[model samples]
Every structure is written in C-alpha cells, then in structure tokens.
Target chain A: MQDPQSQIVVIIIAITIVLLFIGILFLVMIWSYNNKKLQMAREKQQIQDAFEKQLLQSRLEIQEATLNAVSQEIHDNVGQLLSYAKVQLNIMEQQATWGQEELHAIKDTIGTAFTALRNIARSLNILKHAAATRVQIDMLYLPEQLQINIHDNGKGFNVATALTNKEGLGLQNILNRARLMGGAATIISQPEEGTSIKINVPYA
Target chain B: MHIHLYQYTQFLSLLVAILCYEGLCKYKLSAFLPMLVIVNLIEVTGANYRALGYIPWLSNHAIYNLNLLLETPFRLYLMGQMLRMRSNERLTFRGIAFLCMLVILLNYLFLQGPFVFNTFSLILIQILTIVLSCFILLRLALREDIRPNLWQDPYFWVNAGLLLFALITLVILGLQQYMQDHKVMLGGKSLYKAIMPLPNFILYLGYSYAFILCRIPKARSLLSS
Candidate 1:
C-alpha cells in the first residue's frame, strides 16, 4: 500500500546511511591504527632508554667495585710489608752486634723495599698518566692482537696473594681491561725472582 | 551432498573457531565459539529439513527465531567480559540480558504463541543487540590505553565484527516486512537476496580472521599501556 516514489526515497536514504556508516567505520579504523603505531613507538623508545641506563649503571658499579678493592689492598698487604721493613731497619740500627755483613744485608733489604715502593707509586700514577696524556693511537693496519711485556728485575711478590686477594685490583684491573678488549692479561712471578706482566689485547 | 558457497564458508569458519579455542579461552572468549557453532548447526538442520521436502516449523523461521533468542544473551556475555578486561565501566549487561530474555519469553508465551514465527521478539532482539553492539563500539573507540595493536586483540576484532553485523542486520531486519510486502523496493529481487547474506558472510569472515590473529607474543604480553 506504500507509494512507489516514497519507497524509492526511503531505500535511497537507507543506502546513503549505510555508506556513510561504513565511511565512519573506516575513519575510526585508520585513526586506531595510527594511534597504535605511535604507542608502540613510544614503548620501544622507553625500553631502549631503560636498557641503556641499566648498562651505564652496571659499568659504573664495576668501576666502583674495582676502586674499593684497590683501596683495601693498599691499606692491608703493601702497607704491612712496608711497616715490617721499617721495623727491621730500626732493629739493625739499635743492635750493637751489627757488623759490615749485617749492614750490607740491611742496605740490600732497604734498597729492595725502596724499589717495591717505586713500583707501587708507578702503578698508582698510571691512571693519572692516562688522563693527562693523549697518546697517539695507531689505527692504520691495526693487527688482530698486540702483545705487551712488562718485566722488572726486583724481589718478586707472592703471586698467589696477588691473584687470590679479594681486596686487590692491581692484577684484576689489568685482566678486566684485557677482557674488555677481547684478550687477556697474565702475571708470572716468584719470591726472590723477577716479575713479568704480559698483556695480549685485540684491536681493529 | 551438494553444499553451496555459504555452507562451505560456514564450515571453514567453524573449523577455525574450534582450532583457536586456546587463544579464545585465554581472553575469556570461549563462550562465543560454542554459541556460533550452535547457530550454524540450527541453520544446517533447517536447510536439511527443507531439502528433504518436509515443512519446517513455521516455514523454517522457528529455528531462526530460536537463534535470535540464543544469540542476544551470548553477545551480551561477550560484551560484558570484553569490557571487564579493557574498562572500569560498572556495566550490568546481566540485568539487561535477563530483561530481554523475559521480553522474548513473554512474546513467545502470549503474543506470538510460539507456533507461528515470533516476529515481535525477533525484531526486539535485533534492535536491542544493535544498540548493545553500538554501545560496545563507542566504549572501545573512546576508551584510553587500549591494546597497542588492536588488530591482534581478539576482543577488538570480535566487537568490530559484531558492530558490522549489527549495523547491516539492523537495516535488513527493519526493512524485512516492508521489503517482503514490496519486493521491488530495492531495485529488484536479486539485490535484496544478495545483500541479505553479505553481512552474515562478512561477520563469520571477521570472526575467523580474529581467531587466527588472536595471539599475545611472550615478550609483548603486557597489554595496552
């Protein structure tokens, strides 16, 4: 019973409405997709920053741990040996039975102690030297590895103590540096013998 | 059996829905798949009955009317669970569902009397469903801090499909009686017939795609913001 023209108008209106609704759906879809992409990008950036910050914190912690161990070593082992040497010198000076041989023995002992003190001072000064000097670095034809040997003809230290002491960074720092370069550092020494420090480091 | 394109699509959708049951359960969307399967089965049964030369109850509309009744509550359940995940909206979809169910029951008991097609209840359910679907879509679109990739989100795809289905179906159902009375209202018989199945096909296709895409990667499991 509906008029033909009225029915045509209603159908046309319905189709238009449906098409407009579909358009709105598509607009919403595009907006949602873009918003999601932006959110993901923001999340990825936050994750990257968090990872970098953690890496920096851990590196600083390693450095701090090494420094604390080194400070403890200086106060304990090296200081004790130096104090013992001073006590021996004082005893030799006070004793009346001290002869030329005794004097020579004391003199040799004092000389050995002085050389040890100088070695400790040089080791302590190496960091300051690195900071002050801008040494020329050769990058041309860089080898796969570069080996450095440091030898000293002085009364040797306890290799076991240097390697095992928890409160010592002298040898460990060298090892850590070598490891960072994808290489290694090895120490060979014995009591009353000479000492050798070997460093094998990789370079590009 | 001479199965047509619609039947083939329906079976494929059901297969995919079953296979993605794990992903559905993870997001509490498992209830929807069973309801879908039941609806499909009812359609297939109705089709078989007609093909066998048997007169279907109320000319095959009883089964469809039953589908209408079952589908609304399932949709409300899905909407409630989906919203519970993404928003803090104190929705009482359960109460709305119970009320709609009562309305349908009253129509079936008194008005339509269940022997004939429950046209009143059918139209009512369709309108209510369309309104609920729109509400869900609005909440989802305006809600802040949704999944970073809404495409991969099962609920997003599900609700999107529901909204699409509801929108198109609303127009179809609203004009059903009018179109039946006046077949030439939409240009011709062919156009109306073609358009009727299109929304249903699109709805199932969307659900299948959603099932396949609904996975939370182990690293990306921390959803939304």
Candidate 2:
C-alpha cells in the first residue's frame, strides 16, 4: 500500500509542475514583446533610407539645371551677336572702292570663321537643351502637387542613347536632383520623336 | 466535494475553454486563436473523462469515451499547430499526419484494452510521448525567430512545465507497473485519489494563462495598463 508520506510527495511534485507551467507562460509573453520591438526597428530603418535617397537626388538635379541654363545663354545670345557683327563687315566691303582683293579674301575668310562659330554655338545650344530636359511629377496626390517639370526641345536622340551619356553628367544630374526632391525622372524618345521627360516628385 | 472535484475541475476548465473561444471569435479569430482554444478544450475534457473516471457515465459508454474517440484528430491538431509554426521544409506535414495515424492506432488498442499490456506497449508509447514533448519544447524555444513564442523570451519555463508533468506521469505509470509485477495492492486508494488531480490542475493553470494572453487583448492591455 502507498504510504501517507508517499502521497505527500506526489502532491508536492504536482504542485511543482503547476508552478512550472506558469513560468512557461511568462516566457512566451516575453518573446512576443521582443518580436514587436524588432519589427519597429526595421520600419524605422526603411523610412530613413528612403528620405536620404530623396535628398541626394534633389541636389544633383539642381546642379544639372544650372549648368544647362548657362550653356544656353552662351550659345544663343552671344553667338547671335557675333553673327550680326560679321554681316556688318560684309556690307562695308561692298561699299569700299579699294577692291583690295586680298583684303576681300581675308574678309570672306573672316566671314567663314564667323559662320563656323555660329554652327558651334548652335550645337552647344542643342547640348544645353538636352541637359535642360527636366520634369517634375506629383506623387503625393497633394494639393498643388508640389511638382516641378523640366522640359527640353533638343535634337531628338534614341531614348537609350540619351540615357547613356559618356562625356557629361547630361541627364544624370537632372535625374539625381529629381530623386532628391523625392521623385524620379524618365525620358521617352525615339529616332524622330522628341524626348519627353517625366519627373515624379513626392513632397520634394 | 472530494468526489466531485474531478468533475468540477473538468467542467471548470471546459467552461473556461468555451469562454476563451467565444472571446477569440469576438476578437475576430486569427489562425492561431481558435486552434489554441480547441487544444485546451480537448486536452481538458478528454483528460477529465479518460484519466479521472474509468466508469462509464450515464448509460452512455460511447459518449463517455467520445473525447478519446475524437482524440486522434485532437492530438493531431495540437501537433499541427506546432509543425505548421515550425516552417519545417520536411517532416512537418508528414509528422502531423503520422502522429494522427499513430493516435488512431493506439487509441484503437487502448479503448479495446481488456486490450492487453502486451509487450509494454503503453510504456513504450508513454516514453516516446515524453521525448516528443521535450523535443517540442526545445523546438518552440530554439526557433523563436519563426515561431511565436507565447511565453515570451523566457521560453524555458514553459518547457519546464511540460517536463514536470511528464515526469509525474512517468512515476505514476511506473508505480502501477511495479505493483502489478509484484502482485501487490497499490497502497491506499483514497490517498492516490486525493492527489491524482494535483498534476492535472497544474497543467490547467499553465494552459489557462498561456491561452488567456493570446485570446484576451484586454487582459494583456490590463497587464500593461
């Protein structure tokens, strides 16, 4: 027969088991709390990374726009003034009596040089316009949209070729700045079709 | 009161379980919630009927063993939650399927037990069960990243609860066997009867809180509040 002492031992054991069960429940709760903390941290990291990328992109786009504006002024206004100056010299030659064939030849040569300068200016203007193509899109669906649109009407190049500019930052700077504005820029073009640049901005 | 303690605790545990289920449903059931309540339901009621009273109840022998009859799927369900949470590339689904089938086979023999003690079958099964439970505790704790650690960071404590119950079960089974082998009476029946529910009550307490934490957001909020 099982003694009373043995029965007491059994009760003690059972009590211990009950206590242990409570302890286990406590442990599982602690684990859940830690899991929540980890999830919160991951969310915070994601937000920070997104903000930094937007800032960097915006800064680059601004630099590109400034360079293009300067290039356009030098190519259009200054180059045109030089062209008119050469035409005035040509009229003076027609009125002068001293045929000075050699001088006339020299004047013609000067005219050719002026013509070359104008052509150079025209190409520079195309390059400047290509760089200036910028667009701002509204992403927030916010009022007033916080949008910026940069547009350029330069010589149309293949969409792929425009993207892979080797000599200059070209569209790259504009793209970088657009990103800073919490946006992205995409160019659509074909051999004959003009490039259409779209920049989508989010609270930029 | 002593005669009714077994029935009372079983009913109490069942009532708690039903209330928990209603609460979980009210909260809009998650994948984990309903299953958890059911786990407690079957374990409590089945343990009540099978372990507490061997005598058939109310001219309903079939109904008396109904919990055991449904136990295969019930036990399988408990294991399924573990395995599903395990995210095991292999053995998870298979493990649940195998255990479910195993329970069917064992229960068939068990219910039929006039069903001999042939070849230490119950002992072997009990041993294997303890080992499996220990493994479960370890798996739940170690795979904390993937599995929802319900007992929070102190997972060892939950495992400890299982271990303690299993050890008690082992000792009881061993005592029954030793007395049978020696052809001796199992001591004073009244003493064992008094203490029998102690281990079970402890297990319930463990389950009560573990489940309550999951089901009742208010309980949790209150803890913090």
Candidate 3:
C-alpha cells in the first residue's frame, strides 16, 4: 500500500487532469465561437463594400449622362444661335451707311461673342470626353482604412498650375469633399497625360 | 545530465522565445525573454539542487516558496500589460498582486514557515491566476476587432495556457491533503509524481507556440489595439 502522502498526490493529479480537460473544453468553445463571429464580420464587410461600389458606379453613370446632356445642349442649341447672330450682324454692316463705326464695332463685338460661345461648347465637349473615356475606379480595403483610386485616360492639365489658379476649383472641390468625409484626395496629372485621383478614408 | 521531460519542454520554449526575439521586441514583449530564462533556471536548480551539492539551507521548497512570492505578482503585472488594461483595472490588478504577496510573506513567516511546501500560498496564487486568466480570455473572446485573428494572437495562447495550468494546479494542490489521508493510488504509483509534470509540459509547449506566433508580421498590427 502506498503512503498517505503519495496517495494524496495521486488523487490531486487525477483530479487535476479532469479539471484540465474541462478547461481545455472551455477554451475550444471560446475559439469556435469567436471564429464564427469573425467570419460573420468579414462577410458583412464584404457585402457593405460591394454595396458601396455599386452605389458609386450608379452615381458615376448618372453624372456622366447629365454632363453628356449639357454638352449636347451647348453645342447644338446655344452654339447655332450665336453663329446666326454673327451672320446677321455681318449682313447689317454690309447694308448700312450711317453709323458705320458703330455697326463695325457691333459686328466685332458679335464676332468675339460667337468665338467665346464656341470655346465654351468645346470645353463642355472635353469634359464629356473625360467623363466617358477609359475611367477606372478601384476600391482597396486595408486595416481600418479604405482607399479609392479613380483613373481617366483624358486630356489632363498641369495639376500644380490648376491647383494654384481659378481652374483648380473643381479639383479643390474634390479635395474638400474628401476632407469632409474624414479622408484625403491626391490628384496626379500633366498636360496630355492621364489623370489619377487617390482618396484614403478611415473606417471601422 | 538526466533532464526531465518538463525541463526539456522548458528549454524548447526558451529556444523558441529566443528565435522570435526580434518580433517580440517589435511588439514590446521583450520581457518574455528574461522571464523564460529565469523560469528555466529555477526549474533546473530546483530539480537538481541536491546533486549539484548546493547549500543545505537552500532547499527546493524554500526556493519554490521564494519564487512564488516573486513570480505571482510579476506574472499579474505582465498579464495586465498584455491585456492593455485601463488605469483603474491596472490599479486593481496591482492591488491584488500586492495583497497576494503580503499574504504569502505572512504565511511563510508565521503559518507554514519556510521548510514546508507553501501549499496555502500556492493555492491562493493559483486561484487568483485562474480568475485573472479567465477574465483575460473572456475579454479577448468578446473583443470584435481581435476576433478575426484570435488564433494568431500570442496573448490568447498565453492566457489559455495560464488558465489551464492554474485550474489544474488549484484542483491538485487544494485536494492534496484529502487524497494523502485516503491513500489514493493509480497504477501502483503516486499520481502526483506521474502527472504533475504534465501541466508544466503543456504550458511550455503552448508558450513555444505563442512565441512562434509572435514572429508573424501581422501579429503586431493585430495587437496594436
């Protein structure tokens, strides 16, 4: 027969083993539970990202269509009206004798106005091209951060000069909007070069 | 030298910790390196004190009792740091550790003395450790941010191992006197001698795995919160 001390030690060990097994069981249950939660969270995030991407695509399509409509209006309606006025002014100058200087000045003013309207129509067309050309939007998900990149193969302007001058208001608006959303935007462009805009935001 | 299985496991854990020192340092867990070294030294010396012809006064029981006085509080502090406990929680843990240390000193000086195994203090420390480990595990399980990479977390493994070790030791030591009085036996040998080392082995193995996990590049980011 073993001594009482040894017997006690033996019992302690036996009971300990049982308890350890129980402890292990608890750990395994926690692990399994947490893993399920993590998987569910990942799936939810994926769904949200897909939804956001779709929403963005729809918004872009609507914006493109609106720009196209405006471009067409300026080129077909307003542009033709300006040209007709210029032609009328020219005919009036050819027929009138009195107030000839005034008529010439009027004709020159109309000619300048026609040229300005045409320039405006051409600028709208360029904007339409930018909206319709090869444009790519990529959404990159990082830990706690979301990055978006928009690229367009359209005639690009000097980013530095545009940002410093009145022409940069559109770019400034983009930057300001991103900042309002707790994000930042970066635009990369050069004359005749493609444009790429990157925005980074933090999300839970 | 005839190294015990438990000792071998300890060495293996130490080796893994050393191998992952760079990664551990990056995460500010370099303390584990010295802690493991100290634990191995204690284990080796305690096991081979007589053969090495150490002073008669420095018995294994006395060494272990001293270790208990020091190790328990240190471990609590480390756990608190790993869990990123708030200031209030940290204060509470520090208070508990201080109280435990005080109790251990009183028990050593007046109650059990130094010659005998400080079973009372051991049980108290083990119970406290079990509670702390449970709290940590619960916190980890409930945290959504860490849930995605829970398995890769070194603290999860460390806490799990600690919980298991504390639970087993608490049960075994708590019932030691009762079993001894009853002459309990298993396979004609004292069950304590046969199985006591198992928990240590399992714990060290878990630690080794945790150190390996610390080497993962993403571990730092996962633990940043």
Q: Is candidate 1 or candidate 3 better by TM-score?
A: 3
Q: Highest TM-score, which number?
A: 3
RMSD per candidate (Å) reads: 11.5, 9.9, 8.2
Q: What is the lDDT of residue A52 in candidate 2?
A: 68
lDDT of 2 by residue, B42-154 (tens): 54554445455565441222332343344434443443444335456346656755664565456545743323222243344345445555565656544534333334312
Model 1 over residues B68-121: C-alpha lDDT tens digits? Answer: 667767776777777663333444556667888898888777877655566677
Error of 1 at A117 (Å): 14
lDDT value, residue B204 of candidate 3: 88
Candidates in descending TM-score order: 3, 1, 2
Where model 2 places Cα greater than 4 Å from the true spot, the runs are A1-204, B1-69, B81-104, B107-225
Candidate 1 per-residue lDDT over residues A71-103, each given as its tens digit: 676666566666766777788778857678876
How accurate locally is residue A134 in candidate 3, as Cα lDDT from 0 to 100? 79
Model 3: colliding residue pairs: A8-B179, A8-B180, A10-B191
Fnat, one value per model: 0.00, 0.05, 0.74
| Local lDDT at B57 for model 2 | 43
State the lDDT of candidate 3 residue by residue for B1-225, as single tens digits: 556778888899889989999977765667777777778887787888788776755788777777776676667667776777889988887787788889999998899888677889989988887787777787888885734456777888888888888887787655554545565556775555556687787788888888888787774545542
- TM-score-superior candidate, 1 or 2: 1
Evaluated on the second chain alone, the candidates' TM-scores are 0.81, 0.56, 0.87
